[model samples]
Target: PVVSDFKILKNAGVQEKESFHPLRWFSLEQNYPNPFNPTTTIRFKLPNRERVWLAVYNSLGEQIRTLTLNTLNGGTHTIVWDGTNDIGKRVQSGLFFFRLQTKEGALQRKMVLLR
Candidate 1:
């Protein structure tokens, strides 16, 4: 390797962030307003582009609503659940679990919906 003379450029450009930090693993964050009445937001992160499956299930582990079933880019994503079922019917108030699935694996979290 040969070292060539180089000069530092002053204020050439600056990065928006000090450093770029990408998601290292797939994960699901807890839904905001855990005990929600009408709607709640679900957030997840993907290290790479992949097919995603987000759904809500009852305490019995029965899937009631399919929030998202598509391919998403590698980044943080969010979806809103309006406390409804697959058929657009409002569900009863109780403790429910939401699951996020991708090729990497699966992650689930609990949320409650109140009528």
Candidate 2:
């Protein structure tokens, strides 16, 4: 005769790993003064440490300038786009887009440049 030992594992209903911080939806606020003159402020927030990239693009989906490109901490941050290209050349007044991308996700906002 052989004796068998069986053990049931409990607490299986309990979670083990820590849950993520409430996903603070990242946002791209509208550039102040719809038709910004010389400069404008762009704002965004990060819920955790992530590689952030903030750039400006023309209506044609062309990258105009890169405002931020580095590892950032979890917090709110802002950058100013002076309505210029990568070479410091002022762009023509038209519709533009401010894009933000991170490990979390990506967000895009529309802006206007007024000469």
Candidate 3:
């Protein structure tokens, strides 16, 4: 059975984060420390509740990792990558792409991992 968990309690009663620091539009920020070693932070902003999927790919276009996350709220969110693949194997230094997809569209950004 596929299980979906929602943290309604925490999100409940909380106003949209964008209202406080509103986003001009939906966006995906470039990973910080672009040429990162073993780890990096990826940030994005949403305008509404939606199912968000994020994945990492190698320069050859093969999916290497999936950053597991639940349904997201309309606001900014941070995701961390540890330079590992789905099987927990450490990847070597090179160029990679992080793809964030929603019903609206998919945003893909390039990043580098330096070992």
Candidate 4:
């Protein structure tokens, strides 16, 4: 039988509740501790498993670091930026942008770093 309304019934006595698979689309959340010192965390959600390309860019729109370039499972995931580049060199304090790209599309957000 087809299940409509994006839900299913449990036991006869139990009431219907929202499903656990709540994520329906791709999303990128802002980094915590906006003006972080040593590190910051980035979070994102995926509706399905797909290849992800996440990177951080400078104010000049130049790529500074490629955080991830691999397939991630469907669900919420987290990444941490340690104020360093791909070469493991520390970056200066400034505004930066991070982009999360997937097969569905792309999402971008800005963050700040404090020395």
Candidate 5:
């Protein structure tokens, strides 16, 4: 026979039990205006408070710039990317990617830049 570990609470002759469920976190979007000339926005959401880092990279996997890095509360947030590098220098027109890393998982989406 198998035994399960569970506890019951009684308050004034009433009994109560508790249960648990798993949570799943995810990001919901790809940026618009890809192949943009100047700027574009990236949006995502979190299910709980977590440390997050958002960055942009070139096709070669080299990080171009960091858009955000901090602990954020559960909700939606957006970041704008101006076609530039970490040094504030304008980048060339080509394929790029926006990446998000959090306690749950990592995600990446492709974008483009145009002169």
Candidate 6:
């Protein structure tokens, strides 16, 4: 469902300069409960507004899930994985990698799931 109404604004003869500072890009944090079961949380920080993609890969280097977010504002955001694959089926206990991709770059972290 559409949540917000689109708005149109007239140009105010001003263009905001994109910051080249280190803080302008996005960042990813390690998943909590390093060794998780059923579920886990992943936190990230987007210092500047932009689109992003979060994905999960198995130990065999095959993608298991892909999460895409539309334009998001700059700041911290959190997402959760229920230890399931893209098809909504539970995955086996093993090592997995979760990666956050953005126009700026990509970040990945390792996690373990216990049955």
Cα-based lDDT for every prediction:
0.94, 0.86, 0.87, 0.94, 0.87, 0.88
Q: After superposition, how far is residue 65 of candidate 5 from its true place, in Å?
A: 0.3
Error of 1 at 62 (Å): 0.3
User: What is candidate 1's CA lDDT for residue 11?
Assistant: 81
Where does candidate 1 clash, by residue pair?
A: none
Instruction: Name the best candidate (by lDDT).
Output: 4
The segments of candidate 3 whose C-alpha lies over 4 angstroms from its true place after superposition are 1-24
Score candidate 2 by TM-score against the native: 0.76
lDDT by residue (tens digit), candidate 4, 11-115: 758588977856789999999989899999999999889999999999999999999999999989999999999999999999999999998889999999999
Q: Cα lDDT for residue 106, model 4?
A: 92
lDDT of 1: 0.94
TM-score of 4: 0.82
Give me the runs in candidate 5 sitting further than 4 Å from their true place. Answer: 1-23
For model 6, how does the per-residue alpha-carbon lDDT over 54-92 read when each residue is reduced to its tens digit? 999999999998755577878888888999888999999
Location of the lowest summed lDDT over 10 successive residues in candidate 5: 1-10
Score residue 50 of candidate 4 by CA lDDT. 92
Backbone clash pairs for candidate 4 read none
lDDT of 1 at 85: 98
- Winner on TM-score (1 vs 2): 1
lDDT at position 106, candidate 6: 91
Q: Superpose all Cα atoms of candidate 1 onto the true structure and report the RMSD in Å to 1 decimal.
A: 6.7
Encode model 1's per-residue lDDT on 5-44: one tens digit a residue: 6667898996696788878889999999999999999999
How does each model score on TM-score?
Answer: 0.82, 0.76, 0.77, 0.82, 0.77, 0.77
Cα displacement (Å) at residue 42, model 3:
0.2
How displaced is residue 92 in candidate 6, in Å?
A: 0.5
Q: Backbone collision count in every prediction?
A: 0, 0, 0, 0, 0, 0
